[model samples]
Target: MSIGKKLANKTETVRGAAKKYLGRATGNTRLRTEGRLEQAKGNTKQAGAKAKDIFKR
Candidate 1:
């Protein structure tokens, strides 16, 4: 994966974790669900980047 994409994915994952924690603390189901979705999005992006790298090779 490109460095920029890697960094962005990591940031997303971290932000998701933070949001999930905040949601849990505040008893907000919607925020917690959003956090889970964000984390999944980050993972999907990372997977796509890896696939691109493999195909480039």
Candidate 2:
């Protein structure tokens, strides 16, 4: 897990949040679900990367 992956995960999380809100405001269920999934994926990636870093130490 390199810094790039971590950064990407963080960025994805933020983007996902924005998308979620946008979806909510528009009442678009599909967008909302997509955003939620993206958020989860980002969180998972970040956690995995952190775990890898910890093990590396």
Candidate 3:
């Protein structure tokens, strides 16, 4: 993937991790679930990008 897309995905993953930890510390199940979903979404996107790059070779 492009640099911008890679950065965006990484940011999302980092933000999600922060939110997840914050939610755990504050006992917020909703926030925790949202964080987990966000992380998964970011990871999936990154994986898809990698697959595309591999196929382009």
Candidate 4:
């Protein structure tokens, strides 16, 4: 995968984790769920990037 894509994917995952932690600390279920969703999205994007890289090989 490209460095840019990897960096973006990692940023999303890290942001999501931070949000999840914040939500948990604040007792906000919605925020926590959103954070989980964001993390999933990041994971999906990373997977797609990897697949694209493989195909380009």
Candidate 4: residue 6 lDDT (0-100): 99
Candidate structures ordered by TM-score, highest first? 3, 2, 4, 1
Q: Model 4: what TM-score?
A: 0.85
RMSD of each: 1.3, 0.9, 0.7, 1.2
Higher-ranked by lDDT: 2 or 4:
4
Clashing pairs in 1: none
Error of 3 at 41 (Å): 0.4
Show the lowest summed lDDT stretch of 10 residues, model 2. 1-10
Residue 53 accuracy (lDDT) in model 4: 88
Off by over 4 Å in 3: none
Error of model 2, residue 41, in angstroms: 0.2
**lDDT string, candidate 2, 1-57, tens digits:** 777878999999988888898899999988988899899889998998888889999
lDDT of 1 by residue, 1-57 (tens): 669879999899888888888899999999998888898888888888888989998
Q: What are the lDDT scores of the predictions, listed in order?
A: 0.88, 0.89, 0.90, 0.90
**TM per model?**
0.83, 0.91, 0.94, 0.85
lDDT of 4 by residue, 1-57 (tens): 779889999899889888888899999999998899898889899889989989999
lDDT of 1 at 13: 84
Which has the greatest TM-score?
3
Of candidates 4 and 2, the better by TM-score = 2
Q: Which rank order by lDDT, best down to worst?
A: 4, 3, 2, 1
